[model samples]
Structure formats: structure tokens, C-alpha cells
Target: MYRFLVPLACALSIAASATAAPRLVEPRLHIDKEHIGPARIALTFDACMGRVDMRILDVLLRERIPATIFVTARWLQHNRQAAATLLAHPDLFEIENHGAMHVPAVDYPTSIYGITAAGSPQAVAREVEGGAAAIVAAGAPQPRWFRGATARYTASSITEISRLGYKVAGYSINGDDGSLLGARAAEQRVAAARDGDVVIAHINQPSHAAGAGVAKGILALKKSGVHFVRLADTVAPHPTPVL
Candidate 1:
């Protein structure tokens, strides 16, 4: 019995050590230029919490540009009017899950960008599923994608999210550093986006200048004839992970 226990403990230690550490990755979508034809960009916004940034929405509405929005259950519950407005324009917006409580999808006791993580596989499931359920309850079609808060995840969490039958939405360009950037900085970053780029910005901070800049950058992209597409419409071949 003692010999068996020793081997079992050693195996457990080995397995634990093999688990990969959490990585901060910027996930990039592989756009097929031949199939897509011309420059195609996907603009994704995180409605994590707080009021909707009308500055950004208004531009999308006025210009008829389509965008994918990842919303948290908390955000949906708090911004009913904004949710309704988004739902009204099914042609321009596709809503996806951003987790239930706006927690990072890390299967350990850790934090990402100052936000607490899900901390366990079970908790991660709860966060993802809860957000999906909220979208359905709000009268939108079931979400096919999930973008965890902070856009950061543990390898195990990413696997778990995929196992749950949702594609993890990752961004190639960060238009706003969590809505912390000023207007000019955000505009510059967003306007510089290239073809096949997946741009991520925030739509939950109405007062933040980043939202205004995002609007301007999107207009600039439109002026340059850069076509916009939604994640649901294009095939995002395996995301390239950035360390």
C-alpha cells in the first residue's frame, strides 16, 4: 500500500506541473483573402457593464456598419433600454456572451487586469452558460461565441469554453485599453487596423473618450472602403495566440 501511494502522489505532481500557466494572448482571426475578397474587418465590442456608449452605437447605426457585441448578464440586466435598441437592429448587431459576472476565464485563484477569475472549471462553466442563457432570455437567438472578460484565459479555460460548444472570441486589435485611453489614442489605434483584423473595444463606458474615438476610427475605416463583417458571417480559422 505504501509503495502504491508513493507512485500515485508522484503521478499527481507530474500532472499538476504539466498544466500550463495562464497566458495573456491576443487572439487573431485567420481571414482568407481569396474567399473573403477585399479587406474585411470584424469589430467587436464588450458591453461588460455600465451604460451603453451611444457615441459608438450611433455611428454604427448611422453608417449601417455591422458589429458583434459581447455582453455580460450584468450589463444586459442593467441596460435594458440599450439592449432593446441593439435587439431592434438585428441586421447590424450580433450579441454574444461575455460571461455572467464579468469575471476572467481562469481556472485558478487568479486575477486578470485587476478582475477576479472564475477560479475553477465549474465556475467557468457557470459564467459562460449564464451569459448565454441571459441572451436567450432577452429574446435574442442563442449566442454561438463567448469572449471572457479581460479577453484573457487559462489554457484549460479555453479548452473548457470550446468543449461547451462556443467559439472563444479573441481580438487582433485592441482599440481601447479597457476604455482607459483618450479619444485620439483610441482613434489612432483603431484607424490603423488592417485587413482581417479583429478589433476589440468597449461599449459600456459612455463617458469615456475612447468610445468617441472608436466612432471616429470606424468612420475612417468606412471612408477608406474597409468592409466590416460579423464573426457569425465569417469563418475565423484557428485563432493565432499571442503571448
Candidate 2:
């Protein structure tokens, strides 16, 4: 199962209403935390598709920043050498499950942007477990966290995924807005991050402008004395129930 190219329709689904509430039937959910501490933050990257952003990888390697990377099976197939390289630095990177095919992690019949939800509880589990299987097959440690295709999920889907024994990793900051926010805006959004934020940006698609912004913002944060930590160092809080 592979997602050839991210469907453009996924844009609207990924950019769901910022003012909506999360419902069991259909929910738009993510986390919002001002600061986890005074000067500590966690940087999580997504290798969802496309080429690995060496620019982002270079900064993390040079600074030795800790990051939790959510990798989809499709990406693993596309970037094996890079994944192996990242795994070689176990101390700096924690590999996690994104999904088998980069499908939205929901059981609803609705289509997000243009990507359809997994559609059934069982399908969701397969999407998740398949991703983990890919990681382990590559000789990496089993993932402890799962971040869905577009970071969106139904309430039940979250519960189901949790029941499977992995916590869903949601970010406090949308650093790249699925990589639509230009490099500068993406950089500012991340650089202005408060303490304890779990910032997510794509490590795939190096050509995208967002990756560039994330690198600069990460570098700026490092210079400002902000300590970058892994998702496991602290905790990836579950999303709150939408109002």
C-alpha cells in the first residue's frame, strides 16, 4: 500500500476549521500547550513522503538535537538508506509509526481533503500495525507513538489506537501546516514556539520551502538556549476532548 502523491484535496481536510469542536462521529483535533517548561521543547519530524530534507537533517545532526520521527511505510520504502542512517544515531532519533500507506487514521466514511479515512476500526489498526511492522522489519525499535497521516482522527479511532498499546503523538504547534506555510512563516511559527511544544514539520520533500524554514527556526532555537528533546524525554499528551 503506497500513497503515490498526496492528493490536493487533503489540503482542505488537513486545514480543517480552526474553530470547530471534536465530536465522536467526526472530529478535528490536535493539542495546544503554551509551554511545557521554561526553555525545553521537543522537535518531532514527519517523513511522510518525498525526499528526505537533508537541510533539516543537517541541522539536527550538527546540533545533535533529539527528535521523534513518525515514518510511514511508503516513505520507508522510498528512503531506506536515509532511515538506516537515522537509525544509526539511536541516541538522537526515536523512530515512530506514521501509517502503512499514509492514509488518514479515521474510521469515518468521510474523505479528508481527498484522502479517504481508513474506514473501519480494523482498517485503522492494520494501517498502524503495518507501519510498525515496516519499522521493525527495517531493524528499528518498535514504535511507541503513532501520528496519523494528516494528524487528524476520530475520537473512537484514537481510543482504538490506544487500545492497541501505542499513544497517538499530537503536536502543540503546527509548524508547517502540512508544509503550506512558506519557509519564513514556518520558521517564525516554530522559532516563536513556547517551551514544551512538540513541533512537527516534514523531513521528506526537501524541495518544499517549509523544510528550509524549519531548519532555520530550529537553528535559531538552538542558539537561543532552547534545549531540543525527544518525544520520549518528556510525554506526548493525548488530545483533549473537543468542546
Candidate 1 residue pairs in backbone clash: none
Off by over 4 Å in 2: 1-38, 241-243
Candidate 1 positional error at 170, Å: 0.8
Query: How does candidate 2 fare on TM-score?
Result: 0.84
Error of 1 at 206 (Å): 0.8
For every model shown, what is its TM-score relative to the native structure?
A: 0.89, 0.84
lDDT of 2 by residue, 1-243 (tens): 236346655666667765354454322223334445548788888888777989999888888988889999999998988998888999999999999999888876667778888988899999999999999998899899888887888888989999999888877778998888899999998998767677888899777898899999999898898877787776446655442
Residue 169, candidate 1: alpha-carbon lDDT: 89
Worst 10 residues of 2 by lDDT: 24-33
Per-residue lDDT of candidate 1, residues 143-215 (tens digit): 9999988877777788899999998888888999999999999999999998888999999999998999999
lDDT of 1 at 174: 90
Regions of candidate 1 where Cα sits further than 4 Å from its true position: 1-26
